[model samples]
Target: MVLRIHFTAEDLLGTRFADGPAPLLELELAVAMRRRRDPDPAFARRHRSLAAPAARAIAPLNELVPATGAGPFFLDPLSAGLEDGLELVRRATRTAVRGELDRICRNGLPVTPLLRGLAHEDRQAWQQLERSLRAAHTALVDPVWPQLRAGFDTDLAWRGQVQREQGLRGMLAGLYPGSRWLGSTLEIAVAKQVEVRLEGGGVLLLPSAQWTGEPLCGPLPDGSLLLLYPALTPLPHLYLAERAPAPGADPDEPVAALLGRTRSAVLRLTLREPTTGQLARELGISPASASEHARALRRAGLVTTARAGRAVRHSCTPLGHRLIAAAGTPARQA
Candidate 1:
């Protein structure tokens, strides 16, 4: 059970990371996570709580992106944004739609009226799908978009450094679990064994916030490979309640009393490894104030700060986490 990707020198030269997170691809993974997959219990519970509205909304997509197996190529259309991607899906030709539906059936998914209508390019069915996609994005993606964006920025910065210092092979080696970079071939362990020839088309690396599974690779509409991997940071923020806390709520009083209120909040914010500016924006403090607190925490070994591009990213160190735990702060769900 392995997926071997054969790459030529030209393919390596052409390999690149995506510009940012793909909303539609995230939606697909969100649907898949809900559908027959094992995920971290904390993540699963949080996802279910957040995705309740999207569960029904994603019905039209279930047949295409099943709990397992191949889905339609048009699903990840290499678009830069959600609306653009949806528009691309909306314009999928009847022949293309029918071909994909037939492929799904061949993979053992039953054909239903929705699939049938989509196969025939029914106008009402496409409309329903568009609405459903919009709903899913709003429910599952919109709430934590800022967090997603921050995570994306940090991942790209770190990956760029990896690419610069370790070259393409090193970047691929650390991408996902069960993957190895062996000379000209990238092998990934999976349930099914298959070989892919890049043929100089290269690969587009897409980091996903919601995809907790093993890496997935497939061809995009443009004949290039799309490799989706979990983002570098785990999204405990996703496990948080959607509602803002009631005014004057102090969940971190134990830690706050020890570290003072502002510093305590800063510590929790660093759990997601926000940039200095992002921390400032999140706490309504100046960047200098944020940096000062971060420096203090770093000096105390409570957090670690690293320069990523022009921004400095801060993350809670092991000691910081233990301190938060000892103080009995909720910190994050997991």
Candidate 2:
């Protein structure tokens, strides 16, 4: 049930679809570096140490791209509305990322509802946005593609060598259980590694290039990369789970062990206060079964039920809060 994977930077560069375009890769790398270099000394030191090589490799990219300081890419409406389209894509990406992270951290499982909704709601808008960005990149930024490609290829090769030497696969396997090692690719030639479920689930994609030498992990066969660079492999449906504690009362218990069928059902219904009937409808269980579980939770001090009008509503108690908080902590540390 556990999968692990390793990727090198070269794999990332290979995923580029454009034959010629401005070096969007460099811009993205700069943004990543800025994020990694936190103001806090300890955090900065860690990230910087991990990101150093990637940063050094892309040094030339910095020179070529230069910071605009105008905020994310903008399009002049009069020109072609490219900026507006890019902005829309940026917003969509942020929303998707945040939703996935929230689902992972809170539910201890991927929440398909959040992501599925985006696809349904914005399919047309996303398609149009993609077209606009592509047109802009091809028309306005094509001059820099050759230089960008060279820089990207060199960095990816170097990063791959480092990963191979350092037993990156073993390190990743230890860090991420149930991860599968997939090959690498390039998003604008900024080395990205991928891992996907061999059986079923979502893919994880990560960018290997960093300023401090820290490992980068992302969705396997990341959709963003596929959309921007279509010449590469077909993008797969990737479920990204943010690093989070497994759900349950005991950290020592395996997720499977702690979240047995009944416990999981109980936890889901009790996440927020609900009456027995509401719990039954949510869980597809009989009212009697729901009442039984509520009683069990009450006995465990995880829930407190009171009569409101004619129906009983179950709510979490202080003890329940403590249990939830404890469960939310990183399982490894706990």
Candidate 3:
């Protein structure tokens, strides 16, 4: 089956990629994927690793989002970050919470204690749900977050490159698995048939590291549709524990030697497409130092720096991607 997204001219103009992956959405999808049996060996291995604490960390979430059917959209609030999203969930009104839970239950999902308490606006239930989300994120997301961020950056860079070279339609056609850009409409492959009219509401495209299934289409808080799919840039190392660096060997030594450790580190971080301040914070350096390093890379044609509003964003150039790839880095796909 396919999901047809009809678009207007304004919708076409407004459609764009999100700034980065949505942490809350990714967390929910990761939890959902972890519960199922996947064919990938890496996912299987990772699933097995979480088999012990997985139930306690993720069981309550099933009430909010059962094994099937739509869950409460409030769970994946469109916010600045995970904590902010969780706060939104915490602050969801009683009516909204009850309405969504009632809707889910109507779909045949059982009324668990969490769901019942949430439906009744119970404070303790909210706290328990929030704790489960935090614990699940710490277990499943924190370990691979940096790598996921890097991979997302690589995919965003690629999408930008595609749009530059192939126009909006071309980029949209290859945006996700089985996506077809058919003039006024974009079609996406899914298990069920559905149609969405983007009557100037546009759309937000988000890539996922954990969701290996078909594309997911849902509404954002702002009424814009969100299309979530597996990230295009492959970072197999994130899923494979054996891919870790061997004992006592510095995997980055070659790149560090070539570009010097600090500069090389800066180059690698550019894959996350961070701003000067973000780079500074991540590298524990002053903004001045980060700017200098970025400037050096830009001068060497290994990085591209762009000014967005007041912030200067740094991204890897194709040459920079090749150099990082040669160094066997997790980010930067060539």
Candidate 4:
């Protein structure tokens, strides 16, 4: 079924994309996907690795969001926002928690015993909820966060360009095939039939790497939208680690001649845009030495660097991407 989202003048003005993914929301979605017996092998591997802790981590949350579907009754309070630190969860308020729980019960949805007690503002329930979120982060997200954050950063850059040149109407129309802009109305393909009249309330479009396909759409208390959509295209390389060079790119010829072996290795490692510190640790090079090479490559226009959050990140430019793909012959013996 299609969810028809009607936008008012104010909503059109207020509608904007989210800055990035919400870790907690992503976790919730991941757990939901697991429950449904996800078919994709890539997602299956990631889910299997979390099997031990994930079940325990997801027990409480499963009440809030089932594997196959979610009702709006409890979704909003669980947003936990986009705070990279998971601060929204740490500061989860009892008042807000109580209201959402009350609403869920009123809506006649099933709730776990733990969720029942939480409506009474039980400290134990709150603490357990907090711990589950944190544990899930450590077990499921921490190992992959650097790559996740990098994906988010890159996706935002692409979206910014799309919105700036084409405008909101254009962005909505071009976002993905599952969604289309029908004049003032925006229709999203979803299993549930929902028609929301967004009276100029803001719409937060979140691009998630975790939710493999389709999109999740909901409304917030503030009358804003929470649209979480999987990336339309396979994001650069979400499930795969970027290789430094083509498998047979010779390490001793062509471009390698210009940068020397050590420096050559540095340039190729940047295909994934690792931070200066990360790159150094990976290559066993000193930070100072890595920085020097980064600067040299930046000057040569073969690579570029940007400050992403606390890390000064480096990435190969298109020129560099092409150069590396065409470089190196293979290990040549003496």
Per-prediction TM-score to the true structure, in the order listed: 0.68, 0.24, 0.69, 0.62
Better of 1 and 4 by lDDT: 1
Model 3, runs deviating above 4 Å:
67-70, 234-236, 239-334
Residues 178-207, model 2: lDDT tens digits? 233444311121233333323222223232
Candidate 1: deviation at residue 272, Å? 23
The number of clashing residue pairs in model 4 is 6
Which sections of candidate 4 miss by over 4 Å? 51-54, 68-109, 164-166, 233-236, 243-334
| lDDT of each residue in 174-234, candidate 1, tens digit only | 5765478788899987787889998778999887656656678887767789888766543
> How well does candidate 3 score on lDDT at residue 271?
86
lDDT measured at residue 90 in model 3 versus the true structure, 0 to 100: 84
lDDT of each candidate versus the true structure: 0.71, 0.38, 0.71, 0.63
**Candidate 1 clashing pairs, residues 3+ apart or interchain:** none
Model 2 lDDT-worst window of ten: 232-241
Model 1 TM-score (2 dp): 0.68
Q: Write the per-residue lDDT of candidate 4 for residues 1-334, one digit (tens) a residue.
A: 8878888888778877776666666666665666666434556666677666566876666676655445333433334344534565445467766776666556554877778667776789777877776776666666666555555664465556456756778666545554778888988777768788776677888876555555667766687887776553222234353434323335445554434445566777788788999878877768876786676566445578999998999988765665555553332211
Give me the displacement of residue 253 in model 1, in angstroms.
Answer: 21
